[model samples]
Target chain A: MTNLPQNEANDPFVDFSDVALRYGDENGTLALSGVDLSIKKGQFAAIVGPSGCGKSSFMKLATGLCPATEGSIRVAGAPVTGPLKITGMAFQNPTLLPWRDTLRNVMLPLEIVQPHRSRLRAEYAKYVAQAKTILATVGLAGFEDKHPWMLSGGMQQRVSLCRSLIHEPQLLMLDEPFAALDAFTREELWSVLQDLWLEKQFTCILVTHDLREAAYLADVIFVMSARPGRVISTHRVDIPRPRTIESTFDPAFVEIVQKIRAEIAQVRKESKAPARPAAQEQVQ
Target chain B: MKAKHRKLAEKLAPWVVIAGLFTIWQAAIFIFNPRPFILPSPALVYQSFIDYRDPIMAHALFTLTNTLIGFGLGILVGAMLGIFIGSSRLIYAGFYPLLIGINSVPKAAVVPLLVIWLGIGQPPAIATAFLLSFFPIAVNVAAGLATVEPELEDVLRSLGASKLDVLTKVSLPRSLPYFFASLKVAVTLAFVGAVISETLASNDGIGYLMLQAASQFRTSLMFAGLLVIAAMGIGTYLICAFIEVRMTGWATRKQTQVTGGG
Candidate 1:
């Protein structure tokens, strides 16, 4: 515990250096390439890009769901070769096991990750108490016994968030977690997510198509080009803590969103051209 | 009150339909005055049922036992094969078509081949039942496992869940509703397979009784045997449905909630 701060300061929690992922044999879909980026310890990073820019693919690579065909990825100063135990991910869909109620769904990670998995049965009461607390944080206090199908999409996603955080993972990966929700629900979840992240300060990476969402939640936003997705640019947000819906209207926030939107639009336009961009094509 | 009334109506609907069918059969027999050999009246069938109750009970018991045994074996072998085929793309690719090919060759057609290999009597009946019942279970279980959402797999996989963990914790549980569904279908199919084999070659059983009655021109007794088989099929189907409702209630609950205005 005493050496934790120093350990955190020395290395990026997630480091992708010249990473490339090809799906199949030699002539495969090159989903991601030259994805060199790093999230500093406890930083909230958002990745925004055009459709099919491999944003989800990047999440897969960082989480070690699949191995990069080229280059090295290091998380916490160690190379990532397989699925990392220190990370938890929430996808666009809630993906909650319909059979399990909210409390059990939230407790899913506990059954899979860590010393927790071994200890869960013995410390069952303690874990259940912990899960209840997490669910309350996500505004799901009274919905514990309800199955996912019984819950609204937003509530289900909240349950998914609680599940992802239940293991208290060091890194949280969210790939368009609120993309499927209605606008109101999406905004509500953005705040719910923001509060959770603020409370824990886990090193986070969000892959999303929503620019305003990226601008509102992320400390730094990475913009990527289309197709053989590459980080085209990076922007730092200097917004104050506890940024709200009002903050989204602030000129600085709006400007940041507009800039990202322009960048993505440009990328989309470039992708439409028959000729692939030279800069992105050249391997780093 | 309204919900309770609806529930009552649902339960009575099947009984009413059955009674109506019996009434229609009786009327048709009375009007046409066909020979009992062609189509026995409900009363005649009932009389035959009482007259031959002893033999009928014995033979019905034999057929039911064979069906149960074969169905049980089908569950085991089919579940194993389903898990095997489902867990690996390679095996699924190689064996799915072969399974389809085998399943497509009617169980009735296979009964003769089963008789040659296992000789006659209970062995052939049970083998035929086992053969007929296993295919659907295997296919359904495999489909259940195969159709597990990729994103859901990612959620577990990212947690460092082992392959076995994924199968046990998610895949197997997810496939339960499918397994039960297949059980409902397979149970009925197993009955058919057993009865078919029994008819073709057997000393005793409902099928044999029906065959004997037909040969002796005891058409009412043959009709009684058919009625017994029908009752057994419905009974087994109901039992399967009851168990399915109990075990995979979550799947059904989801569907109901969806229809009840989301």
Candidate 2:
């Protein structure tokens, strides 16, 4: 493994250096390339890009679901060898088990994660209390006995968020977790998520295509190029904490969104140009 | 409120229809004056049921016992094999074709073989029932496990869950509705298999009783035996259906909504 740079070695929670991923075997398509990223502990970062730009792939690598074909990924100062148990994840769909009720769904991770799994049967009441508290924190107090199918899509997503946080993981990975929700519900959840993040302060990496969402929630936003995706630009938001829907219209916030949009537009243009022979040769 | 009335009516409709059919048959027989041996009226069938009640009860008990024993063993073996095959792609690929081949041969052909291997009594009846009923349980279980959402599996896997954890906690529970559905079908098939073997070789089940009644030209007694078998089939099916509703209420809530809407 290569030695970390001096600053990165100090306090970076997640460090990726020259990371590249190719799907399939030796001659497969390169999904991401030449990526170097660092996120500080407890920082909320967002990755925004055009569709098919490997933003989701980056999240997979960070969580150790898939190995990077090249370079190294370090999360919490340790090399990610396999799936990291310290990370919690949620996706566009709630993905809750239909057979399990909300409380059981929220407690799912506890049944798998260590210390908790061994103690769970003996201390089930305590675990249930913890799950109930998390559910109540997310405004799902009365819905504990409700099945996933019984809940509205937005409510299901809320339960999913609670489930991810129940284990109190060090890192939260969200892959477009609210994209399937309505605009109204989407905005409402932004505050719910923001409140949770404020209270818990877990490190978060949000992969999303919505620039407004990124501008509203993230401490910093990273924009990526089209396929063989690499972070093309990173913008740090200077907005104060506890941002609301009204703050999204703030000129500084709007400017940040527009700047990121412009970067993506530039990426789109570059992607549309006829491919260079050198790039074609490398893919082959 | 209207749905509740409709549900009550739906439950009563089948009995009403059966009664009406029996009434029509009695009227038709009275007016046409058919031979007693050709078409037995419900009255005559009922009389025969009473006259042969002792023997009928004994034979019915014999068939019911064989069916239950065979069905239980089928379930045990079928579920184990189902889980094994469902958990692995290689086993499913290797065993599925052989299962299909075995199921395709008419079970009647196998009844004689079973009789030859194990004499003409409870053993053959039980073996035949097992051979006929296990396939649906295995196939449905495999299908249920195979169709589990990849997203759900990923959720458990990301949490450091082992393969067994995923199966017990997620896959098995997800397959309950399918398992129960197959059970209903398998129970009916088990009855068919038991009777088939009883008709071919055994001397002590509803099938044998009906055969003896036919040889003696006692058609009403034969119809009585048929009615008894049908009743048993429906009873076992209701039990399975009740269990299905209790165990998989989550899976069928949407179906209930659709029915209630209509």
Listed in order, each prediction's TM-score against the native is 0.95, 0.93
Extract clashing residue pairs from model 1: none
Instruction: Output the worst ten-in-a-row residue range by lDDT, candidate 2 chain A.
Output: A275-284
B1-262: candidate 1 lDDT, tens digit per residue: 7876876897799999999999999999989999988888899999999999999999999999999999999999999999999999999999999999999888778878888899888999999899999999999999999999999999999999999989988999999999999999999999998999999989889889989988999999998998899999999999998889778888898545533522
Model 1, CA-based lDDT: 0.90
Residue-wise lDDT of candidate 2 within A1-284, one digit each (tens)?
A: 22446676458899999999999998998999988888988899999998999998998899888899999999988999988888888999898988899999999999999879999999999999999998988899999998898899999999999988998888899999999999999999999999999999889999998899998899988888889998777899989989999999999999988888877887787788897222221110
Per-model CA lDDT versus the true structure: 0.90, 0.89
Instruction: Give the Å error, residue B216, model 1.
Output: 0.5
Regions of candidate 2 where Cα sits further than 4 Å from its true position: A1-10, A26-29, A276-284, B27-34, B255-262
lDDT of 1 by residue, A96-124 (tens): 99889899989988888878999999999
Task: Supply DockQ values for each candidate.
Answer: 0.86, 0.67
